[model samples]
Target: MRITLERSNLLKSLNHVHRVVERRNTIPILSNVLLRADGTALAMKATDLDLEITEETPANVEQAGATTVPAHLLYDIVRKLPDGAEVFLATTPDGGTMTIASGRSKFSLQCLPEADFPDLTAGTFSHTFKLTASDLKMLIDRTQFAISTEETRYYLNGIFFHTIEAQGDLKLRAVATDGHRLARADIKAPSGSEGMPGIIIPRKTVGELQKLVDNPEATVTIEVSDAKIRLSIGSIVMTSKLIDGTFPDYQRVIPTGNDKEMRVDCQTFAQAVDRVSTISSERGRAVKLALTDGQLLLTVNNPDSGSATDELAVSYESDAMEIGFNAKYLLDITAQLSGTDAVFLLADAGSPTLIRDTAGDDALYVLMPMRV
Candidate 1:
């Protein structure tokens, strides 16, 4: 295969596809990216068997052919070339090596037969829908932090997507939970998503999709089946395998009867928690929240180190109670809040607390308390 393309265009397409290639692979062709030149474009593909990404860039194709080369190596070479430089890629007659030439720099990369590269066959899609980039991003960003990293419960390692009827409307919801915390977000269901089956998108695929939905105005097409999902944005296509286990009943864990309400400035509470936790022990970094009438006091005590306490005024009318939470977890939940005031609904020191934004986003969070 032989092709010539702008360095910027090649790099942009490579940047999108090369991330799917693992750094180490047992199969020789698995670490390589497949390059095919034909019909005035060069198509680049990279995969780790479970996930695949493909992108096409405008190029001057001198010959219609295909080959595979080291993904990272090709990316590195193209990245170091001068801006606006034109990159020329050509494979040798014997198909043993591919040469890259840009201005004064030249390099040769070993080539593997394109036939050896594996394809992630998407058998049949049962549902297809379109989502605006902003909506998709909102659902992912709100719930991604709560996805469990535990390998034992593979179902919890991904964000669960499904449709449900709530408040007399069909809504598309995304939910993610580790054992300690849960995040749930919803959007008005799109037209074609009404009867779609629930699917658990794996963590890695969620991460890649998150990066691609940067343009808020762009539209993303999603095709889903029971075992796999395919997403397309512009000239890029991504296909990934879904997690193979049933997600737990997340609705049971979201507390519904938390009666105590505490309203505090989100930024102020987050900063106070950060300052108090500075003296906490590494392993036991729990911040204690003591609330009484309209006053709130944040404290962190460690026998091995000094202790800290910060007091602030809050809008709490419930009976006095003390609760402890992991300082890191508190910060994570606070960072996702968009409103100035955060409302926390609490039942007691031991029950889960519900958090919501005053700005009226369709997202809610549940956090379990830790022992002080």
Candidate 2:
């Protein structure tokens, strides 16, 4: 196989695919990326058994063939090359080695036969829909932080994506939760998306897909089946296996009886939590919230360290209320609100609290109260 591609184009495509390749793998081919040249384009693909990514860039394909080369090594080489330099790649018949050259520099990278690479199914799926690049970005950014890092409950490790009815209209909702906190965001679904099956998109796939999308106004085609999902944007496509286990019925965790309400500027509230958390020790990052009339007092106390308190004018119309929560959780939830102010619905000190955006009913977050 022989092909010539621009250095900048090669670097961009390689950077997208290389992240999907694992650094250490039992199978050598898993550490390599598959490069294939078609009529006028070169495709770079990398997979980790569970997720597969393919990126295509414009190139001059003198000969149509395929080869596999070390992913990280190739990425680093092309990244260090001159920005506009043209890259030439050629492979020997034996497939024992591949030569890569840019300008005056030449390097021979060990190669594996393209047949040795793990096979991926470019399977056909039903339920195809288009999502605006910006909307998908907002869905991911608003809920990904609450994804669980614990391996025991693998089902809770990804964002649950599905279509649901809101006020007699179908809406796309992304929900993520660790035991302590949960985030849910919704956006109006385009026509023909109603009745699609719910799927849990794994965390690693979410991070990879984020890189391929740039223009907020661009449209992305999404296809989902029972076990896998595909997101295609221009010359890139990402396919990932969905988690098989059932996600917890997250609706029950959302508090509806929380009558004590407080409305505060989201940015100010987030900054106050940040400052107060500084005084708390590393082990327990706890912050206290005290509400009365229209004023909110934020405090953090640590027996071994020090304490902090800050006051902010807010909109509160209920009896006095006090609650404590993990400062990190509070900050994460507040940061997701798209507008200036956030509404906090609290039941009591030991109960769950509900949070929503003041401007719209598009998204909601729930936090489990902590003992101070």
Candidate 3:
């Protein structure tokens, strides 16, 4: 294969595909990326058996052919090249060695037969839909932080995406939880998305998809089946195997009987939590919140370190309540709020607390209280 492309173009394509290439793999071809040159474009593909990404970039093709080379090495070489430099790539007839040259620099990399690369087959999709990039970003950002990292509960290690009826309107929802805290966000479901089966999108795939939709103006096409999920943005395509497990019914975890209410400035609450957490040395970093009429007190105590206390004016008219929570969890939940005020719905000192952004009803968070 012989192709010529700009250094910027080569680097951009490499950056998109190399992240999927496993650094250490038992199979030799899995560690390499396949480069196929045809007509006016060069297609670069990388896969780790479970997930695959392919990106096509414009190139001047001297001869149409394909080859496989070390993904990381080629990415590094292209990244270090001068900007706007013309990159030349050629492979030998036997496909044993690939040469990459730019200006005064030249490097030879070992190549494997492109035939050895595995193909990821995405079976027929049962549902396909379109989503604006900004809405997709909002869905991920609001819930991804709560995804469980515990491997044993594999079902909880991803975001549960599905459609549901909310106030007579169909909405697309993303929910994630790690047992201690839960986050749920929703957006208007696009046309043809009705009756789509709920699916758990693995954490790694969610991360990769987030990278592709950084441009708010872009539109992403989504295709899903029982076993796989596919996302396409412009000339880039990503396919990932969905987690084959059922997510728990998250509705049961959200507290509905909570009657105590407190409204506080989101920024003030987050800053207070951050400051008080410094004195907490326990594993949970527990912080105590004392609420009363028109006032809220934040405190942390650690036998090994010290104690901290801060007070903020809040709009609370319910019975006085004191609750304990993980400072980090509180900060994470508060950071998700896009509004100036965060509303807290409390049942008691022992029950889970419901949090919401005053700006919208489409997002909610639930946190279990710790025994302080």
Candidate 4:
């Protein structure tokens, strides 16, 4: 195969697909990316058995053929090449190596037969829908942080996605939890998404999707089956395997009886928590929140180091009480809030506390309290 393409075009497409290839792999072809040159385009594909990404870029094809080469090595070479320079790629007759030439720089990379590259076959999709990039990003960004990293409970490793009837409308919801904390976000369900089966998108796939959906104005097409999912954005397409497990009923964990409400400036409360938690040890990052009539006190105790305290005026109309929470977790949830004020709903020192962003009702969080 022989093809000529601009360095910029090659680098951009390579950057998108190379990340899906693992750095280390037992299978030889898994370490290489498949490149195919056809009529007027070059298609590049990379996979790790679980996830696959493919992208096509316009090119000048002198001959039509396909081969596989080290993905990272090729990307590095193209990245270091002079900008706006035309690149020439040609394979040897024996299909042993491919030559990369641009300006005066040249390199030869070992190649594997294109037939050896594995393909992730996406079966029939049960549902297909389109979502604006902004809406999809909002749903993923809010809930991804709470996905459980524990390997034992494999089901919680990815965000649970499904359509549910809520507030007299069909809503598409994303929910994730790690036992200690839970995050849930929702958007109006798009047409053709009704009655779709709930699916657990694996953690790695969710992370990759988050990076790809950067253009807020663009539209993304999603196709899902029971075992796999495919997302197409512009010239890039990604297919991934879904987790084969059942997600727990998350509604049971949401607190419904929390009566105490405390409203505070979101930025002020977060900064206070950050300052007080500075004296906390890595293992013990709990920060105590003492609530009274119209004031709130934050404290962190670390016998191995020192202690800290910060107080802020808040809008709390409840009896005096003290509750403890993980400072890191609190900061993470607050970072996602959009409004100037954050509202906390509490039942007791030991029960789960519900947190909401005063900006909207689309997102909510639940945090389990710690004993101080």
Candidate 5:
């Protein structure tokens, strides 16, 4: 295989495909990236069995062939090359070693037969839809933070994606929870997505998809099946196996009767919670929120550390109530609010509190109170 490509273009594609290659692999071929050169472009593929990423970039092909090489090493070499340098890659007839040269620098890397690379088959997709990159990013940003990290409950380790009918209109919803806190966000369902099956997109796929949709103006095409999900944007294609588990009925956890309400500046509330939590103990890191007619008091007390209290004027008219919450949980939920004001609907000191952005009703958060 012999190919010539601009250093910048090769580096960009390498950065995308290399991340999918695991640093530690028991199989030799799994640690390398498969490079196929033909016609006018070079295709790069990397996978870890469960997830695979393929990218195609334009290159000058002197001799068309395919080979596999160390993904990280090639990425590092190309990254450190001088800007605008042309990268030349060629493999011997036996394909034992690959030669890489740019300007005054040259190196030889061992190559493996591309035939040994694992083949990833994307099963039949039941649904295919298109979404604006920005909208897709919003869905991920709003709920990914609440995804559980516990491997035992693998079902909760990914964002639950499905379509729901609301007010006679269909909408795409993303929900995630880690038992303590839950986040739900919705957007208008794209056409052709009707009757889409609910699927749990694994955390790793969520992260890779986020990077694939960096261009806000670009349109992302998503194809989903019972076992796999594929995301495509321009020349990049990301495919991953879905988590085979059932997600809990999240609506049951979302309270419906909570009426007591308090509205406060989102930034102000988050800052106060962050400051007072400094005095909280390392284990619990709990903070108490006392809300009265027009004032809200935030306090944290730790026996080994110290105590802190801050007061903020708020829009609360219900009877006085004090609730205990994990400081980090509050910060995570509040940080997602894009509006100026955050509205909290409370039932009692012991029940879960519901949070919403004052500007939009498309998203909501629920947090279970802690015993202070």
Candidate 6:
């Protein structure tokens, strides 16, 4: 394909599309990006078969053509060019090599016939709804840390996305768990998603979507079917096949009627956990929380290492309680807090503890306690 695209625009699009291309591929064309000059824009597409990303940018299309070139190599070449440099990409008729030129630098990339590239049918999207970029990022960032990496439970390797009833209203929720801990967050469901089927978005798709949602003001339109989920933003689109297993019913795990409540500064509590965790040995990753009369003491003890204790003033009036939790797990839950304080509701020492923002009930978190 022959086209002249701004260096910055080409690099920007390539940076996003190249990441979707696997570093190593058994198929030759899989390592390359499909470049098609159509109308007045240049389209760049890359895929690993499981997921695909396509981006379009404004370009001068002197002669409409298409070819496949090494994704990473093209990105690297354009990245090194001087800022504001205009990049000219041209493919010879034989389609054996593609040339890249910017100012004084020039490089030739080996090309493959676009016909050899595996084609994915861009199925007609049945449902489309818009989400603020920042909201989508929030959905992924807050819960992705809990996604299970265990190969045995492949279905738990992604965030379980579904609609749930809360306070007599339906809300879109994202939940992730690795057996030990779980994170759940919710946002008001869009108008068109009332009856949409729940889907388990794979971890990789969650990651790519995070990168694509950099603009908070940018609204992404999402379309989903039984097997596929597609996201469109501006001039970019990402599609992935959803995981096909039934996600465990998460509602049974979120405890109800936890009455004992404790409120503490989220930042201070997180820092206390960080400091005490230092004393925990590599094998035993537990931090004990002892709460009484408006005070919270975090302690970690390791025979080989040492013991640490940090006390912080909190708002708790319930009976004295002591519970143990994994330091990493505590940090993950605490990191989700976006406000000053977090309110934790505890039923007892052995039951799951519920956490939420002290200011409101927009989102809630639950953690199962460990024996100290």
lDDT of 2: 0.90
Pairwise lDDT winner, candidates 2 and 6: 2
- Computed on alpha carbons, the lDDT of every model, listed in order, comes to 0.94, 0.90, 0.94, 0.96, 0.95, 0.88
lDDT of 3: 0.94
| Total clashing pairs for each candidate | 0, 0, 0, 0, 0, 0
- Write model 1 residue lDDT over 284-315, tens digit each, in one string: 98999999999999999999888999998999
Q: How close is candidate 5 to the true structure, as a TM-score?
A: 0.99
TM-score of each: 0.99, 0.98, 0.99, 0.99, 0.99, 0.96
Q: What TM-score does candidate 6 reach?
A: 0.96
Q: What is the Cα-based lDDT of residue 248 in candidate 2?
A: 94
**lDDT of candidate 2 at residue 184, scale 0 to 100:** 92
- Worst lDDT run of 10 residues, candidate 4, spans 19-28
Q: Give model 2's clash tally.
A: 0
Error of 3 at 84 (Å): 1.2
Clashing pairs in 2: none
For model 4, state the Cα shift of residue 300 in Å: 0.3
Question: What 10-residue stretch in candidate 3 is worst by lDDT?
Answer: 275-284
Q: RMSD of candidate 3 to the true fold?
A: 0.8
Across residues 106-223, which tens digit of lDDT does each residue of candidate 6 receive?
Answer: 8998999989988667677666788888878888888899999998899999998877788889888899988887888888987777878889999888888888888999999989
lDDT of 4 by residue, 1-372 (tens): 999999999999999999998898899899899999999999999999999999999999999999999998999999999889999999999999999999889999999999899999998999999999999999999999999999999999999999999999999999999999999999999998899999999999999999999899999999999999999999999999999999999999899999999999999999999999999999989999999999999999999988999999999998999999999999999999999999999999999999999999999999999989
Name the regions of candidate 6 deviating beyond 4 angstroms.
122-124
User: Which ten-residue region of model 1 has the weakest summed lDDT?
Assistant: 357-366
